[model samples]
Target chain A: MSNASTRNRGIPNPLAWIGAAALGLFGEIGRLAVFSARVKAAAFSPRWYIGQIWKQIVQIGFFSLPVVGMSAIFIGAALALNIYQGSGRFGAEQFVPNIVVLGITRELGATITALMLAGRVSAGISAEIGAMRVTEQIDALESLSASPYRYLYAPRFLAALIALPLLVLVADIIGVMGGWAVSVFGLGFDSTVYLRNTLDFVTRNDILTGLIKAVVFGAVIALMGCYQGDRSKAGATGVGRAATLSMVGAAVLVLASNYIMSTIFVEVGL
Target chain B: MTTPILSLQNVEKRFGKNHVLRGVTLDVAPGESLVVIGGSGSGKSVMLKNALGLMTPDSGKILFNGEDVTQAKGKTRARMRERVGMLFQSGALFDSLTVWENVAFRLVNSGVVSRAKAKDRAIETLSKVRLGSDVADLYPAEISGGMQKRVSLARSIISKPDLIFFDEPTTGLDPITADAINDLIIEQVRGLGAATVTITHDMASARKIADEVAMLFEGEIIWRGKASDVDNSGNPYVDQFVHGRAEGPIQPAL
Candidate 1:
């Protein structure tokens, strides 16, 4: 066949794939539009939005506390044990308290814990929203003139943004407590000394940096969750893909962003 | 004739190698009811999608209110949509919302009424469809298929749209409920003076609600005439489809 006829006769390979991707993306954007329209059309006054916010606070913040706390405690204990063993070989056993404080507060506590939370929250958000989209509820909203984004995504995003930091803060505190427990009990260090050292080792900058990471991680998780879920296609299979992608993608991205943010923070001398 | 509320001029749409719509042209004048009758996969759904701007046509002019609406975008598209309503094949009511909320959706989106007022309007619309106000609080899943269809209908007409499209509106309902819905559709269209275009395989519905009927076969309208002429169109394809015959001009799918 001539090249012109070849081109005219069938779907272009690259164009077909591009068109498929575009259709998927457009479906998501359409969903977002429908979500926003539904909210606008719902006459959900300021009171309704506020109520939604409150609901988010409970769902995102309160419900996440136990997991964040447990994960942080276990991580802190494991780090302390590892540091104590390494320091002992160097005849630097006394350095265990300082290393525990520095490691848990400076990097591991917020970064690792936030990564876990991102996987949990993002996967949940994506699955819930993806299922809703797959089932035609989103279309119903559009037919009714409601915007799905404002109705569905906005409140969830806000909840994650607000609740995640609080969860991280709890995790940070519990993590320090875990480190203290190990330093005092396993290492046979004086409780008072370990407490003083932890207090002295932790700078205001360390806490602030962790909180900032928490906030950034929260936004990333929410964005990925909403994007993947809202854009899902092909029913259950699509929803399953959305949930998996949201979790795995959020976990990887959160860790990667933590490293980048940490580098920027150190370079800026903050 | 009063200006056609909707007009499709040589509209065409194709999906990959499959041509769904082949230079289809039709019109719905003000307050008129036009039904496009065809078998499954005959491009009836695609035609409605094209008119609704859900699917972009490869070529054609769709004039709404005498203005080219084929490629209207942003605010213009939104405004055009605000005056139009659609009933999807599956009722497609939001499972998360109550019946009243679904019915009140367009009214709320118009940003012209308070929530209290919108709810009241929704309830009134529901009542018009013979659904009690008590049904308004029920989720879509809580209702029977017929009731859900009624709620869907209520949602469609609540906006009092100038143009409406019904996709297989009576498809899943039993004979009695389907007839009731068809009558309600006719009553509402007449009452609101809104132009309507319905696509269906149901000849009885076409006869009841259509002022004019067009038969779509193999991506083209093979017959077009007044509703009364459907049975006597003398077109083999139309006869086959209307009678649900197995063997005719439309070969069975292999």
Candidate 2:
């Protein structure tokens, strides 16, 4: 019965299915590249929506502080405790402060903040824009001579690009402080010595690496959200799917890009 | 006759193999209200989108002011869009914005007027539609659907373009509210003196506001005539549709 159905439908071979999937993937990537280029053009265009950009910054950055802060503090405390335990087994408990600061500044701060934002901000943007698309508000904007790329996308893109590094900086400082508190109070370390070691071990290069990663992750989050939302189908289900896809896509892209950037940074001796 | 403000000559559009539009030709003269009536999936929305430059036709010329703008882009498209407005089926008001902001969106965004002045103008426009200023600060969700439709009308006509497209302006409303909206649409379109194209299957609305009526069936304009002549158009499809008869030549899409 399966063979009869396949014969009637003229189904392709497994190799053809693989080829079609590859083609679909490449087509999607090309479309994304084109979308990114259009967004870049719109960003640099003469018309700038400064007010919208400020609004988005306040929404994406200022509103996200509490959650990001809480996550950073907990992660930092956990890392400090784990490092103390592992280093004590090798009689290297004195190195706990250095490693904690190093880890937070170079990796955890930016990655954790981006992943959190990928869940929160990305989904929110997707839902908002997707709702607009389905309800024909985006079409209304177009009819009013407003470009969605300029009005809807560029503002969010600029906001995320400008805001994420600042967020990462705050997360880094808070994380380091959490580590200091844990080491001095919970682990019986000298406060002054831990502070000195943390300050000594963290360099400008370490902070710069995380900030750079934050910038890329920010762009990825906004791009994924806007792209998914703009192409969303018409209806409540469509908008819901777009939001889900935006969150999943942003999270996956953030992690993949983080790995690639880390490799590049290592290769460049950053 | 004067040059048509908008014209579509043999425009066609397709989605893969669906072939939604099949060589549709239409024209809307300045200050004229042309209502295109059709059943669901009859390509009325697609044809309207093509005329509004929201969608491109696969093959044919779309002329605005006698200039072919079938594939216009960037500044040309923007300039064309500035001269046209659309009231979507769902009212499509910006949920984040208040009623006044939604009405004055075009003015403030285009830098044509200051926010204060735009708000004043928005309230004035609202009064034209019989809406009080008390609703200005309220969001679209706070207002009734009929009021939301009024706000959408106000927004579309705020710029006073040369043309307007009303896509099913009275789709989801009670008869009394729908009639009220129809009255407002007639008043507003006449006030703007803009050429208008409205697509709807609502015969009551078509009879109330249409100067000329066109019936679309199977992606083609099957019959067109003056509004009074729509009842006796003699085309089977139009007769079937206008009478809402399910047993005519127009079979249900199963």
Candidate 3:
């Protein structure tokens, strides 16, 4: 009997599958690390592509404002309502303003905004770069000695890095105002009291921590997008898969990193 | 007598169990256009990539201007690359940029010329390809496929590179447009005085642009001769390919 007929081999060997998965994960991680290192190395390299960087900065920073702001406002209002309802059960309704501000400043404002941007900006980056990859534009750049890292990754990475923090800042303000508006009118709480409580409860460190996370999230978003994109296979479906992977991967990293950063902040007495 | 513009010696490349380029050795002289004809998956693209220093051969050497560049890295590789240009199979124009911007890419990126002058030069090059000035402002997505190919051709020559590689110059064009591209390629090669390597299965294109034609089969250059001699080559594989016969050693995929 032939080996193909004799052996069923329907089930994959569990150990082999595990090993392959582990190797594949490590390979992906290694590739990403190498890509990041190159992005850093090209940081101060010549032919800075100042115009491209500026264009990206405007695309990433100014263009992303409204969506991030709108998301923040809605989340803020919802969080205010939730806290008001939950705290009311414990007769601690007065603490709603404080918790809302703290939540917005330290966590939700940054993480939610980053996640939203991951879907919007990161997906956009990946799709655009993936299209370029499938079209062989990246290889074209390499053959021209134009340095894809300097021309493509550097500009977009720097823009996202500079943009996300500004977006987060806008998010934080809009969020606090959202809570304030809900408390002042809808929830029938005093406007001045809510504002005073928000100011008193949130610290500079809280805002700074969120901003720092913004930077990390920004890097993750752009880096994953470019990495997935640069490695995309040729075709529409391949580029589409790359875009999906980039958005999903960047969002997961943002959440994971947010947790880690928050833990470090707590441990460090923030 | 002068050093060949590009040389590949015993170059090998593999993708896992599939060995693509198997000790391929070839050379192209300056002011020559060497068209590499091969069946699909014959590793012609990989061989081009290896010669261009876009991919490292697992072993052997690639020399440009008498300098071994197979292992060239950092500034060395960059310097070698600075003198080389390629037109990708898909034209590969940056979709975000307009036609003029695509043509002026090398000049603008190198900062050798101001953007204003680069655009001027871009229009001038576009005109060389018979592209109208109106096409210059349209994005690559806005242009027809053939126009995109012309724009890609223009971009490749914008830097006046010493060596140029065209990966399937006429793969997806109508016969008329393909012939026009072939003509344009011949003109450009002569006008620029650049060593050229074009990979294609398009026999008409091969015959038109090839000063010398090389046939890549089974990851090796099986036969090479003047373009005019391809039809009379006695090698079975060459005869089969040149004649596009169904009954030969080369099996057409069903």
- Per-model CA lDDT versus the true structure: 0.82, 0.93, 0.90
lDDT of 2 at A215: 95
lDDT, candidate 2, residue B219? 91
TM-scores, all candidates, are 0.83, 0.97, 0.97
Q: What shift in Å separates residue A38 of candidate 3 from its native position after superposition?
A: 1.3
Question: Candidate 3 residues B71-166, lDDT tens each?
Answer: 898789888888888888999898888999999987887777999999999999999999989999999989899999999999989878899999
lDDT of 2 by residue, B72-145 (tens): 98888988988898999999999989999999998999897999999999999999889999999999999999
Candidate topping lDDT: 2
CAPRI-style class, candidate 1:
acceptable
Candidate 3 has a TM-score of 0.97
Best-to-worst order by TM-score is: 2, 3, 1
> Candidate 3's residue-wise lDDT over A27-142, tens digit each?
98999999988986775567578888999889888988988899999999999999999999989999999999899999999998899988888888888888888778888888
User: Tens digits of per-residue lDDT for model 1 on A200-250?
Assistant: 878888878888888778877877787788878867789999999888878
What TM-score does each prediction get for chain A alone? 0.81, 0.95, 0.96
Candidate 1, superposed: residue stretches over 4 Å from native: A1-57, A93-98, A185-191
Quote the B-chain TM-score, candidate 1.
0.97
lDDT of 1 by residue, B3-54 (tens): 8999999999999999999999898898889999988888998899789876
